[model samples]
Target: MNVGIVAAGPVHDIPDLKKVNHIDYWIGVDEGANVLYESGIQADLLTGDFDSIEPNRLESIKQNTKAINQFSSIKDETDLELAFLEAIKLKPTTVYIYGATGGRLDHAWVNVQLLTMFAEKHLDAWMVNSQNEMTVKYPGKYELNKDLSYPYISFLPLSEVVNGLTLQGFRYTLEDQDINQGSSLTISNEWSEKKGTYFFNSGILLVIKSRD
Candidate 1:
């Protein structure tokens, strides 16, 4: 199953819902339920503390959604995190997160970190917004295709150091290189060919496909 999660971020940053393909289930986090409601999408589940949603909007969501998991504002987990846990319980094959970026910088950063949780479970997940699609990758070889919408591919180390980084069919190719966490060497590379391949021997990497 493919699960989609919507978090409370800037609504303008969300991609057009009509074009979002293959999402079998949707989970709305806090004010994000209002987003789904406004877009005429029925949320399969709504999970959040809901401090950000207005009373009427929350009531509307509660009426339309299949299930609701309302929580206290004093909970330990963030609303997005809670929604993510609920998503995993469904055993989705892939998870796509929207409204995860482009509002508060702190929230965006934390949402990026949440990708690692999906990775730990060996499930595929992506954090996508208007300009970028981000995912976490472990040591392995992978193929990437050129996307006209998101033309740049960047690899940033999530670990202290990523070892044996190599790239082929890229504008700026690397061979057996080690990149540090803060290194910008892998930023803004384009596909030299229609398809490119990359490999890393160790450490976690944050792969971001983006456009300006």
Candidate 2:
């Protein structure tokens, strides 16, 4: 199953939720459940402490949602992570997270870590916001198509170093190169053909596809 999750960040930071491609399941984290209701989208699971939500609004959400998992406000995990645990339990092939960025820097950073967590599980996970789409990849070759929507691609090593990096069909090319942390060496690359290929021998890569 493919799952879509909406969090409690600024709704304005995301695209139209109604127009998304087929989503098999929907998850709302705390105020995100209310956001889904406001957008007239149904949620399969609603999770969080409900501390940030108004009492009446929380009641309304509890009434309409099919399932709910409320946690203590001072739990070990964040609301978003709790929601992710349930989503992962369902074993979705892919999970698309929205409203998880463009707010608190710390929260956004945690969400990126969540992306990496899913990637390490060998599941397809992506974070989408107004300006960018982000994901983490373990060492492997990937084929990508040119998209005018997100014309720029950047790769940042999540680990200390990435080894034997190679790229084809891009404005910049690399072969058997190693990139360490704190390097802007792979930022803002453009596709040179209809499709391009990328591969690496070791370490995790954070692939960001973005546009102005």
Candidate 3:
């Protein structure tokens, strides 16, 4: 299955939802249901406390959605996280998250952490917004496609250090280099060749790519 999750971030900057191809399922998190509706995209499932939406809008969403998973305002996981858990249960081949950025810093950070959760479960999850695409990487080899339109790539260590790191086809090459936490060593590396590869032996990394 191919699933798409919509969070509570600003939707005005996202591309036309109708232009997307082969979307088998759509999930709405909190006010995201309203955003989806405004974009003329129907959601398969709605999951949230309805706190962010007005009473009438919430009722309309509940009535229109195929399924609804309501939670109390006081909950451990964020609405987006809950949506992700539900999406994973369906065993989707790939999951795309919209409206994940351009929100509260805490919420954005938590959503970024969700990528790590997906990585742990061996799921392909990514945060896609108007300007950025984000994913979490564990120790392993990664093959990256070079998008000439958006060639800038950045890697931020999630742990104290990412050990034994190697980079190929990048402007800044590293072989068995250690990247410490809070370090800028891996920032803004461009693809010199058609593709790029990176391998790390330990720790987690947040990989972000964006256009100028």
What are the Cα lDDT values of the candidates? 0.90, 0.88, 0.85
Cα misplacement distance, residue 107 of candidate 1 (Å): 1.3
Candidate 2 ranges with C-alpha deviation above 4 Å: none
* Each candidate: RMSD: 1.3, 1.4, 1.6
Candidate 1 ranges with C-alpha deviation above 4 Å:
none
lDDT of 3 by residue, 43-161 (tens): 89999897989898788777778888989999988888899989989998888899888758887777887788788877777788877777888889988889776778998898889
What is the alpha-carbon lDDT for the whole of candidate 2? 0.88
Clashing pairs in 1: none
- TM-scores of the candidates are 0.95, 0.94, 0.93
lDDT of candidate 2 over 143-197, digit per residue (tens): 7888899999998998899999998988998898999988999999999998989
Which tens-of-lDDT digit does each residue in 80-181 have in candidate 1? 998888888888998999999997899888889888888777778989998899999888898888888888999999999999999999999999999999
Candidate 3, residue 188: the lDDT equals: 87
